[model samples]
Target: MSTFGTLYRVTTYGESHCASVGAIIDGCPPGLELSAADIQTQLSRRRPGQSNLTTPRDEKDLVQLQSGVEQGVTLGTPIGLLVRNEDQRPKDYTETDLYPRPSHADYTYLEKYGVKASSGGGRSSARETIGRVAAGAIAETYLKRAYGIEIVAFVSSVGKIHLPSSIAPPSAVPVNGADDNDDVEDSLSPEFRKLLATISRAEVDKYTTRCPHPETSERMTKRIIRAKDAQDSIGGTVTCVIRNVPAGLGEPVFDKFEAKLGHAMLSIPATKAFEIGSGFRGTEVPGSKHNDAFVRKADGRLGTATNWSGGVQGGITNGEDIYFRVGFKSPATISQAQETAQYDGTPGSLAARGRHDPCVVPRAVPIVEAMAALVVMDELLIQNARKTAAALLPAITTLPPTMVLPKGKQ
Candidate 1:
């Protein structure tokens, strides 16, 4: 279950309090320029202690490029990456060894395996996602270099504070393709795509809340502080947009595009719900309004006049910007004490232990983007294979540089 993807697979290992956490990336293309710096950029973003809104524990998370490359070029072998766990406070979780915390994996992990790690929720900790983010950085590099695909995510809401729809990124397509259009269209404009390309993680980090809209970001940060003072946690949603994805990337039947995206998303810690394109709000709209209009693009490929389908239709990419949202529940561990019983039915009260984020959505931003990268990279590889197979015809089967015909037959 730890292994993910078909061709671009990644297997993660280690736990929150373990000596080190790392990943094995098995399917990266050969000759991609990769380095520890590329992987460290994301690990730093996901590492704790960057802000008051997240866990304050400092994990250097300095990644080591163990193998699979030489002189900065990939060898197309299994790439192994490692990040040592610094400042691990396993002692913070000592109390939970006997009494499993409420709403945590402490109880179920014990039931399923008859034994548990007894620290930092073992493999259930958000710290484990470091491996995923690291692996995803590799996938993202390949996807961008190969397909010009770009993925961006930010905090859309924290508690009840939300970035107003007025300042939200452009959604519907621009009919006139103008930058200052007052009227909204059903599809994205060339102007909007231009704007999306300029966004970067450095720009996102300028705001502590990671919401690109400056005014709303300040508000979200204040709200997180309030929750932290109250010793409680709040839940919120993240909206991600994947732009410049080409057509015909998804697989049909069982391994559809959105299906794989959802599976990867929910696999992350604390994710409760997943939605794509117009998602739930689209449910209220009639089919006439919800359906995307097909218009031939200037590039000559048929494009959508609207993205109500969220860049996907019939379980495949249609050369549009695919957008989606993921909802995360409040972290179950809180500083407030709750009355509960021990595993042996003994009466007790438990206040959660360990360094925990007051709101995970802020830190979850990079995790979401990483998971999205993994899914897209996997699907793109499959699509490439399919395209190559379809091009293999009887007339072309005997071509040079591959199959060679006998001297007389040639």
Candidate 2:
């Protein structure tokens, strides 16, 4: 389960309190330029102690490239990466011995594996994502170089404090006591579409909340600070967009593009929900109103007048920007006292002691971008392999015009 992707495989390792955490990336194309600094940029963004809103645990999160490169160029071999855990405080997790840590993975991991790490959340910790980010950076570099692909993610909401672009009209009165939002607002509002088209990482990082909008980012900062002051936690959503993707990527049925994306996003620690395009809102809108209308793009390729489908049609990329949102639950390792059952089924009060984030969406932005890159990269390679293999075969001129693509049309 540690590994992901088919051709561009990535396997991550290490625990929260371990000496080091990293990933091994296999199947990267040879001769691509790479360096530790490139990977470090994203790692730094994801590291703890970025601001008052996040955990106070200070980690440099410095990256070291161990293999698969020579003279700053990838060798097309398995790329090994490592980031040492310098500021680990295993003693802070002493309460975990008595309690499973409410809403945490401590219980489930032990139940499934029959044993769990003695300190921290082990593989369930966000530290495990170090390798993913590293591998994704490589995939991103390749994607950008090969297709000018651009991926950007940012905080869209913190608890109830949502960006104006993300706000939707209130739900209509329940019909027959059924809950539905038939008064659905346009998921791809003109303002939101413009933001997706132009927002950059630099603009997002300017504010600690990473919301981009000045007013909403300030409110989100206050919201996170309030939770930290109360020794509680909050949940939020992250939205990501990928642009300049060519049409016709993704497998049908089993490995649909969005399905793989959901798998990757939900795999991150604290993630609770995943939605693409119109998401849940689409359910309420009539099919005629929700459908994306085809239009001719300036590049002579087909596009949608309305992107309610979020750039994907029939589970594949459609040459439009692919966008989605990921929801992260409140962090479970808060320093709050709670009455709960212990591992042995005894009643006890646990006041957990550990430096943890009050809200995770700001730091989760890069993880979202990284996972998106991996899915796109893997699907791109698969599609490319199929195209390459099909090119070698004799032309099928006997097929009906409706059944086969016309020559030079592709």
> Which numbered prediction scores highest in TM-score against the true structure?
2
The digit string of per-residue lDDT tens for model 1 on 183-229 reads 43433345434435566677777888888878888888888888889
Clashing pairs in 2: none
- Give the residue spans of candidate 2 off by over 4 A: 165-185, 407-410
**Which ten contiguous residues of candidate 2 have the minimum total lDDT?**
168-177
- Stretches of candidate 1 above 4 Å error? 167-198, 394-410
RMSD of each: 6.5, 2.7
Global CA lDDT computed for model 2: 0.87
lDDT per residue as tens, model 2, 222-310: 99999999999999989898999999988988898888999999998899999888787666778977888898988887889888888
Q: What is the lDDT of residue 280 in candidate 2?
A: 73
Worst 10 residues of 1 by lDDT: 166-175
